[model samples]
Each structure stands twice: as C-alpha cells, then as structure tokens.
Target chain A: MDMGPHATFIWTAYGLSATVVSALILRAMLDERRQRRALARLEAQGIRRRSDVAQERRG
Target chain B: MLSFATLANPSFFMRLTDRVLPWLAGVWILLLAAGLYMSFFVAPADYQQGETVRIMFIHVPFAWLAMFCYMIIAVSSIGSLIWRHPLADVSAKAAAPIGAAFTLLALVTGSLWGKPMWGAYWVWDARLTSVLVLFFLYLGLIALWESIEDPSRAGRAAAILAIVGVVNIPIIKFSVDWWNTLHQPASVMRAGGPTIHPTILWPLLVMAVAFSLMFLWLHLKAMRAEILRRRVETMMMTRVSSAVALKAAE
Candidate 1:
C-alpha cells in the first residue's frame, strides 16, 4: 500500500523505466523520419542529375 | 503466396511501418497510462508484502518482454539468413539493442525486488543465473553483429547463434520450477491458471502489451533508419567514384 516506506522504491523504478523506454522509442522514430527525408532528397537530386545529363546529350 | 522478396522491399516496408507505428505508439501510451493508474490506485497491495510487492508490477512484465524480444530477433534472423529476406536482417539488427535494454531492465528490477523480499540484493540461484545468461546472450549477439564487416555475413552468423541460443530461453523460463530456487515460481503463466488476483493481473498484462507495442514501434523505426543509412552510403560512394574518375581524366 501507499502507506509503506518501500512504496517509493517501487514507484520510482516503474516511473524511471517507463520514461526511459518512451524516450528511446521517440528518439528512434524521429531519427527514422529524418533519415527517410534525407534519402528522399538524395533521390530527387539524382533524378535531377540524370535529367540534366539527358538534356545536355540532346543539345 | 507472397514471396520473401516482396516483403523485403524497403519502400513497401516503410509504408507498412508508417501505418503501424502511429497506432502502436498511441496504444502504448494509452495502455501505459491506464496500466499505471490501475497498478498504483486500483490494485490492492499485497496483504503480506505491503508495498514491496508492487515491484512485481514492473519486474514480471519486463522479464516476459525480454524473452519475447529475443524470440523476435531469433525468428527474424532465421528469415534473413535462411530465406535471404532483406527486411529480416534490419529487423534483427534493430531488435538486439531493444531486447538488451529489456533484459537489463528485468535484471535490475528483479534485484530491487529481491532486496526487500529476500533480505538480499541477489542470489546465484538457478533462476537468477539463467536470466543473467539471457542478458549476456543479447549482448553477445549485438557484439557479434557489430564486429563483422560484412552485413549479410554478420546476419547469418548472428542467426546461427540465435537459433542455438533458443535452448536457453526455456532454461531461463523453467529454472525456478525445475530447481528449488529462492525466486518464486511462475504465477502468471501456469498450467492451471494465473494465481494472482484479477486487479493485479490486469495491470501487469496491460503493461506487458504496452511494452511489446513500444518495442515493435521502435524496431520498425530503427529498421527504416538503417535502410536509409545504407542508401545514403551507397549514394556517397557513387559520387566519390565519379569524382575520382573526373580527376583521373584531368
């Protein structure tokens, strides 16, 4: 019960563990989104490079 | 039937992950909130244990998830190594750290629980020793993957190790049961049924589900990042090669 002295230890452990897990999950998701965006940008740049090459060859 | 290659497409997998991650995150948050409230406010504390019994709320669920995470890695590693499933490698890689985290959590919380109940922080009992072995197994797998230069080869090697390590899972689970140990016997998963009261059982189960969902969300995100990292490296290499060719022409 909340009346016991050891209740603090139990609560502290649970709270800290939950916070750590949540932070890790959030950090992973954010990093993934950033990587995805960077890849998309690189893909677009590659497409631009190819189009420029095709135009130069035609000219 | 869909072949492994179809599942291996990075874009296809990304789309699936996008849809799944949000739902998993949302459910995890909701369940965590609800589970905590139930555990702290609703569930009656043990008559004998006072509040020390409350440690079981986190410890038991984490122990379950630690084993569950290993199973995920083992299964994914098999798919990658045997079937050459590309996503499987990334999934197995991402899951290693998360599983290691869970194992660490279980061990630490179990120790904290033991201090008050057992009048000591730890015992070299079979149950405790086997769980410690499980923790080391995760670390070994992580280190093995990191040490190998070739990704595919690493995946195959780790897969073999994981497959062999499957025997340890049962040993960890049944160690307390098989041998007389200071650790209590299985209360949640048993042949007859869970002996714990429903109020306590409900929160524990919810927390377990929340933890599993959180792991899935993170694992998929990590896999996506890993694939993008590979793509970026390939692009950089291509650009470097072209630049070298231009300098040679000059």
Candidate 2:
C-alpha cells in the first residue's frame, strides 16, 4: 500500500487540537490565580458586609 | 458538612490554592508534554488508515471530556437543588462554559478529520447531531443562568434544566447504534473490546487521561474564580451600602 501525502490531514488535526486545549488550560489557571489573590485581599481588609462578616467571625 | 464549609471559605480556598494550583499546573504541563510526545513521535502511524487515524488521539478524548463535563454539571446541579450547596451551583455554572468549549472542540476536530476520511464536513448523523444539541444545551444553561438577577433563583432554575437535559447524554452515546448513520458506532467503549489495535489504543488512552487531568485542573480553577467573583461583588456592594448609610447620618 502506498501511504502518501493525505496522511498529513490527521497529524494536523491532532496538532491543532492539542494547541487549543493547552491554551484553554493555561488561560483558566492564570485567571483563577489572579482572581483568588484579589479576593483574598478584599477579604483581609475587613471589607465585607456586617452580616457576612459577622457570620465569618462567629464561625 | 457545615464544619467542612471552611473548605469553601475564600481565605481557606486561597491558602489551599497556593499549595494545590502549582502542582496541578505542573501536572497539566507534564502530562500534555508526555501525551504529545507519545502521540506525535512515540506512537506509530496507523497501518490501514495511515496518518488520518492520528486524529483519534485528540478527537476521541475531547468527545469523552465533553460528555464527562456535562455529567459533572448535571450531578452538581442536582446536588445544589437538593442540598442548596452554593459551591455546587458555582461548579455547575463554571463548568458550563468549559463543557461548551470542549464540545465545540470535539465537533470542529471531528469535522476536520471527517472531511478527508468521510468525504464530508457536515452530516445530520445521529451522534453528531446529538453532540451538537449537547453543545447548545451548555450554552442555554449558561445564558439562562446569566439572565436572572437573583443568584439563588438562577441557580435553582439552571439546576433544573441541567438535570432535565442529562437524559440526552445516553441518547448521544447510543445514537449511532440506534440509527444507522454516517458516524461510526462505538468501538472503544464496547462490551467486548476496542476494535482499534493496541498501538493506537495506548496513545488514545493516555490522551484521555491527560484530558481528564486537564479538565479537573481547569474545572477547579473556574470554580475558584466564580467563588472569588461572587465574593468581590459582595464586598463592593457592602462598601456602597455603608457609604450610603454614612451619607444619611451626615
């Protein structure tokens, strides 16, 4: 059997899929870390509502 | 369970993430690296179908993850509806976009692979049509969640929809068999054995593991982000309310 150039289609598809999924995973990680840190800062400043803060304090 | 609620505490979550995120990031990078190496270089080209079979490494895994993500959202939604777990709602909501993304990837990659192999890009095949419906279901859940102003109400409503939509997952899986369609019937996930050879099977399995790990890492990250966003919104609203009260006093 003569295996020819059309085989490139499968390799290209796999390559593109890997690239896209990797990009998404990286983006989610960065966004989550950034947002978590920011929220931690806000929580630390005693900036929450009285009711919410009281719940936390009581717990 | 209330005692364990501390796990969901924003500060506790932040602390846990400091320890966990790096490991998860490392695993994602390492696994993807290994999976790609094995997929592209280590794995041999298919004998019968030649290189086009290589597309299975990505297309099959994404298809699995898309279904897996939908199951997660449905289960979490049910949990939220029954127990009113705020985190479950956050999980269900956060997973919608990611699930939709995976589903879209599956469709696009399948189409790309299909064109050369099946000689068509689009077909009203059963498996393909049901998968498209699953993608739309994800979008609908996301849109419905965003449409409501009240978070709690929105969560409950979206949860109901998620649970109701779950009946379609099995339909999506069985569609190829239930109807004679252009799409191939289940081979890997059959009762007897996978029809694909061991060489192709190993890479595909490794890729599936890598995809699952990636999904876990991202789903956790997205859930954490949703939680933080809610916390930030609450903090901002509190500050505004206090400023109004102080102005009234003055």
Candidate 3:
C-alpha cells in the first residue's frame, strides 16, 4: 500500500513498535523458561518447598 | 466462585492464569489482525493529513495503553502497601517494564508523526514533556525494585515511588488543555464525543481494545515468570540453609 510522501515515518513507527513488542514477548518467555528450569533443577536435587514437604508428611 | 483471598494465593493465581492465558492470547491475536486490516484497508485517508493519519491507529492505542499500564501499577502498588496482597507487588513489578516499553513506543511514534506534521522531530511541548516524565517514572520504579535485594523491601520502596508518581498521570492527560502546547487537544475522547469520523474511529477503537488485550496477555505472562523467579529464590535459600544445618550436625 502506498502511504504517500510520509511512508517512511508511518512504516518506521510500526516497525519500531513491532520490534519492541516482540522483544517483550521474548523476554517474558525466556524468563519463564529460566525460572522453571532452575526450579526443576532444585527439585531434582531433592530440595522441596516447605508446603510440598508438609503435604508429603501428611501422607 | 473463587474469592479474592483465593485469587490472591500465588499457586491459585498461577493455575488460573495457565488456563486463561491461551484464551486471552487467541483473542488478542484475532483482534489485532482485524484491527490491522481495518486500519490499513478499510479506513479512508484523512482529508487533510492523508495517509499519515494511518499512524494514529497504533500510535493512539500505544499512548493510551502506556497510561493504562501505569494505572494498573499504581493500583497494584496501593494493594501492596495497604492490603499487603500477595500478588499485588508481583503485578506492579511485572508491569513496570511493559509499561516502560509502551511509554517508549508512544514517545517514538509520537515523534515520528510529529516530524512529518510539525516539521520538527522533538519539541518541548507540555504533553510531550509530561509523557517523557511518565517514562522516567517507570524507569525509576524499575531501578528502585532492582536496588533492594529483598523482594518485600523492594516492593515496598517501589510501591511508594509508584504512588507518588501517579500525580503525573492527570497532568499528562490534561497537558494539552492545561498548557499552550503545540500538540493538539483531545480529539477522540472529549466532553461531547469523539471528533473524528466513524471510519477512522472504528479502527482506532478496535486497535485500542486489541492493544489492551495485548497488554493483559503480556502482563499475565510476566507475572507468572516473576512468581516462578520468587519460587526459585525460596528453593535456593532452603537448599543453602539445609546444607548449613547438615554440616553443623556432622
């Protein structure tokens, strides 16, 4: 679509927004992955949260 | 029915978000697609501004979401401080970077639009300066959270700053009218109604809703990550303490 004389301005605005938003999504996903991995590693080493320990004790 | 207390529990909140996020993501994507199509194809070029008016679809929504995100942080901060709600601080902390991103987008897009329309890339306008201030406030909150090691202490400090910084919101909103800024006054939201034509207004409104859903989806994801990070911290601490105890016993 021809955006007339100011096409650069319009396209740049959309491009920058898309870049920033994608970065946010990537950061969130990476952070979630990192935290989940750390938690899993700890659990595998037999380090459990207090609540989990309490539940096991009740059984 | 889940009560506020149940929702406030981190485990319950995580479970609930896990179920809800997929649906929210779907809706956001669909709405965004529809909005983009309408913005590009359906909406007519402005009689005066021509194709440049197209920028308003995303720019206005970004600007609105920037303010809306800050409002979320401010309310969450209040909950963190007064009620000490478990998820409140997490919500506020997760929202900071997302809000900052939106604010930056607004400033960047606004400047882009300004360059073509006003013949200058940057201006010391009241509205612009206030928004810049808002962006700095977001940065300040993020820094405050990072400076304090303890989560509760960091949350409290950031909460106080968030509360104090909220006064800038109204100033940003009314800056156009409050001062003789080069930026135009409120067109879409005003006393009577939106001044823009229906063709433009529809796409703008659609994009606004889509943007809001996008923010919600991102905020939820960020909050879940934050909760997981805290869980990891606790587990690590537990491991260290148990190791110390076992060594002492031996």
DockQ leader: 3
In order, what lDDT does every prediction score?
0.81, 0.83, 0.94
Instruction: Estimate, for each residue in B1-250, the C-alpha lDDT of model 2 and write its tens digit.
Output: 4567886565676677768977977886788778777777777777765666767788898999999999999999987998887778889998998899889889988987788878888899889999999999999999989999998988888999999999989999999879999998888999899998787788888888878888887888888788878877788788788889999999
Tens digits of per-residue lDDT for model 1 on B144-220?
88999887778888999988897899998889889999988999899999998898888888877877777777787
Query: Cα deviation in Å at residue A16, candidate 1?
Result: 3.2
The best candidate in terms of lDDT: 3
DockQ list for all candidates: 0.43, 0.57, 0.91
Model 3, range B1-250, lDDT digits (tens) per residue? 8788888999999999999999999999999999999999999999988899988999899899999999999999999999999799999999999999999999999999999899998999999999999999999999989988988999999999999999999999999998999999999989999899999999999999999998999999999999999989889999999999999999
Model 2 TM-score relative to the real fold: 0.89
Scored against the native two-chain complex, candidate 1 gets a DockQ of 0.43
Which pairs of residues collide in model 3? none
Cα TM-score per model: 0.89, 0.89, 0.98
Candidate 3 lDDT by residue in tens digits, A1-59 = 99999999999999999999999989988999999999999999988999878988999
For model 2 chain B, give the 10-residue run with minimal summed lDDT.
B1-10
**Better model by TM-score, 1 or 3?**
3
Greater-TM-score candidate between 2 and 3: 3
Stretches of candidate 2 exceeding 4 Å from the true structure: A1-4, A33-46, A49-52, A55-59, B1-14
In order, how many clashes per candidate?
0, 0, 0
